[model samples]
Target chain A: MKDKFGLQRIRLSVQILYTILTNGYVYGYMQGKIYKGGLKYACVPGLNCYSCPGATFSCPLGALQSALNQRQIQVPFAVLGFFFLFGSIFGRFVCGWLCPFGLFQDLLHRIPLFQKRKQLPGHRMLKYGKYLVLAGLVLVGSSFLFDGFVKVPAFCKYLCPSGTLMGALPLLSVNEQLRSQVGGLFGWKLGLLLVLVGLSVKVYRPFCQYLCPLGAIYGWFNRFSLVQIHWEQEACISCGACQKACPVDLKPEQISVSTECMKCGKCMTACPVQCLHWRKIEKN
Target chain B: MSFWHKTLDKRPKRGMWFLLFGIGVVCLVIGIYEGQLEDVYRKAVMICLECIGIG
Candidate 1:
């Protein structure tokens, strides 16, 4: 019997590489410094927390929003272009392979804690939540003020579990003064992180599937991205093997560069006939 | 079925993507010239209190 259900060793390696690459400042906690190197000026194409003590680069989503928030700039071409460039190149492959938060969820789901739901209830409706986050919280909220004093970036300020987990949690852990400063806001953020973590054990990256606006941004470019998965329709037997293999339960053929797919290559690995292949561009 | 095929077949040329990439490079350079890189460095060094909703 073939070891068809074997562990994804290469995928794990890729995930770890990105996690360390994005957050490589090992002395940040000991020295109490966020490294302000030239690399810090660039946007990492993943949902890494910008304020993570060890983070060497700013997160693309956070940098984009921060650039927009500056009233002085009419257009933040550097941040915008980085987003466009990465999106057109890799699409949601970053979510599947690079995002530290996605890796965290993948690890959490590996635990034999409980039987997991392969799909969410009202998932079609829930999928829209990330776009809502992109529009209402990240974009509109950052560009405008909620009240006279309050800053409006609702997703990062109120909802981003990655920011809470990687940023606030680490800061609070090392600094006694920071812990003392923690109040209702800290508790609320912690609660959100807990809920998302809990759901991830069952739902295979609930945050990416539902709430990550960064993933949403990348998903938009998945269809036309340089890196794409193409199905050999002629070779397909329609045996539904790939469909069963999908963690998110999407059909293999339709999953090719689709918004919902993370391009994890599960279908390719699972296909009995070996139909799906990753390509830089489709050969027409 | 016909709609899916039509929409799926509509693809931009490889050269067009290369052109877009060049344009994107130009935008990135312009943004850095406009001091966005400096802004990123400034933001990176300091922990964002607002992002964590600490203050």
Candidate 2:
């Protein structure tokens, strides 16, 4: 139990440290300005809003959508490369440990007021929603949709609660010029953010499970990523403790490399016999 | 098992990951050459009204 507690503390520490490092532009927040620096050329491997005042790196999802929204309609090679690089190395581990929005959801879930549920109703079907968000909104919508002369980053514009909470709220609070421009769209986004916040208090990572396109992209690489959770079948007792411990309620033994597995190491700590362990791909 | 069978085992190999990583690096280089990094920087430095749900 002490080991489990220590592991969770380590994960939380990493999450906090990563968040602070990525969003290190303290002056931006003070001055209500985005960071204009060389670091913005590279994308971060998390769902942090690029518009957030403190964010020093570009968001991969926002960059991909922006690239796709160009009038010439070309493949976003840089964003794809970023995804490939991060996805191949860390996979959905980014979602589990690096994403600022994910950390926000985790903190919200820790609020003791609500009765926590491991899985939402219709979790099996709902889990596929993130993929749809990636395909239909980020990919297709950005590639084609135009609002008059301007192209829309459909997911970021319409659905990203992270943008509303982290980018919109903070910027608006500090910038009087921005506050004057607040309209129905901001209200709608705030409402959506509230719903997600309420849901997060009861359910674990509602955005990650059903809506985050970035999570969807990283999830595809989980099975093939260098970092992986290996299950030793021979040493297994069919004890269901790991499943109970899983934040997403995944059966770790049955599908060790399931795309849904975020590599959070909860199950590793939960296993009584220590059958599950983190392993890198073997050199042939 | 034959060499092919051994190579094609279910377990993920480091070689495959390295190849993918190489491909990612190549893609990143191509993108930088094409000025996509500048585009990313330009977009990131600006306050995105759409992201903030304004206008």
- Assess candidate 1 and give its lDDT: 0.79
Off by over 4 Å in 1: A1-7, A146-152, B2-6, B11-16
TM-score of 1: 0.93
Model 2 Cα lDDT, one tens digit per residue, A1-284 = 44654788899999999999988788988988888888899998998788999998899999999999898978788888999999999989998889999999999999997789977899889989999999999999988888899889999999999899779988998999999999998989999999999999999999998888888888877767888888776787969888888988877543436677788888888889988888886777
- Candidate 1: docking tier: medium
Question: Candidate 1: deviation at residue A279, Å?
Answer: 1.2
- Candidate 2 chain A, run of 10 with poorest lDDT: A250-259
The deviation in Å at residue A119 for candidate 2 is: 1.6
lDDT of 2 at A207: 92
Candidate 1 local lDDT, A1-284, one digit each (tens) = 23264535677889999899888788875654567778888888898777888888888778777776776546778878887788778888888888999999999988888898766899989999999999988888888855465455567788888888878877777877777777898789889899988998888888999889988988887776788777777898989987787777877556745688888878878888878777776544
DockQ of each: 0.58, 0.50
RMSD of 1: 2.2
Question: Which portions of model 2 show Cα errors greater than 4 Å?
Answer: A1-5, A254-256, B1-9
